[model samples]
Target: MTLYPATLLLHLVGVIGLFIALSLEVAVVSRLRVAKTTTQVHEWLTLSRVIDVLLPVSAVVILISGLVLTFSAWGWGHAWIELSLGLLVLLGLLGPVINGPRMKAIRVAAQAAPEGSISPALRQAIFHPVLRVYVPIPGLVALGAVIMMVLKLDWL
Candidate 1:
């Protein structure tokens, strides 16, 4: 196969991996929000560890493959390309700046609480206002990037 098609396939695979990681994060956080017991909280938090690994790996794959595709086939002049790269950076930052610390706090709270029902502190940590606002941003940004890529939007 040609370099362009091979890189395109890799880029698509990366996107699929990214979506899977993001979906798992959402599901785990949703479960953590409703967890009645510390055990359940711990369980869900353990599951989130998968996201910690998957998100970065997928993102790296996406970035490398996307850059290759851009340089090889698409060039850097398209408005959609620029915006999509910006969105990818934003998605990268959101995980570390917003989601990571908040989830760490929730895990800490879960660890400190007893094995019974969830504590107020744990509940608050799980349902942080920031997290509530931040949860949908990644998915929405990713969706927008996908749309732009598919449409080859050229509103530059």
Candidate 2:
């Protein structure tokens, strides 16, 4: 009935959407890592495009709703809100800076490779060490933000 509850619902929806996108990305990356053929890689890459849409939409929803909530009910001084915002920024940066280019490279390699077993370059692109290390970071950061939000942690 009120703005706060409505905005909170929207924020929760955004969080759910974000996790859905992230989970899909995890699945796609896992599949890509072991994909045996160019067809498999291409299929998974197509699925990843769904994430390209979901992640940004969810993020924008979260940000706008969260800002409304912050200004209305929570104020700007809470440590948890600030930390959560920082985590959101980190997630925003990580996707474009780390995952975007790597996934693009994999897509490019998959497109160029002949229709057959995965090529050496495609394998290398899929299993890049940096991507492997980076995959869990966003999930962990999101989890931390959720924890802070729930607990309203203020130990700053």
Could you tell me every candidate's TM-score relative to the true structure? 0.96, 0.97
**RMSD per prediction, one decimal?**
1.0, 0.8
Please name the candidate that would achieve the greatest lDDT relative to the true structure.
Answer: 2
Angstrom error at residue 37, model 1:
0.4
Query: Which residue pairs in candidate 1 have backbone atoms (N, alpha carbon, C) closer than 3 angstroms, thus clashing?
Result: none
Question: How well is each residue in 81-133 modelled by candidate 1, as lDDT tens digits?
Answer: 88989889887976788888999899889889988999999999998999878
Q: Give the TM-score of candidate 2.
A: 0.97
Question: Candidate 1: worst 10 consecutive residues by lDDT?
Answer: 132-141
- Report, for every candidate in turn, its global Cα lDDT versus the true structure: 0.88, 0.91
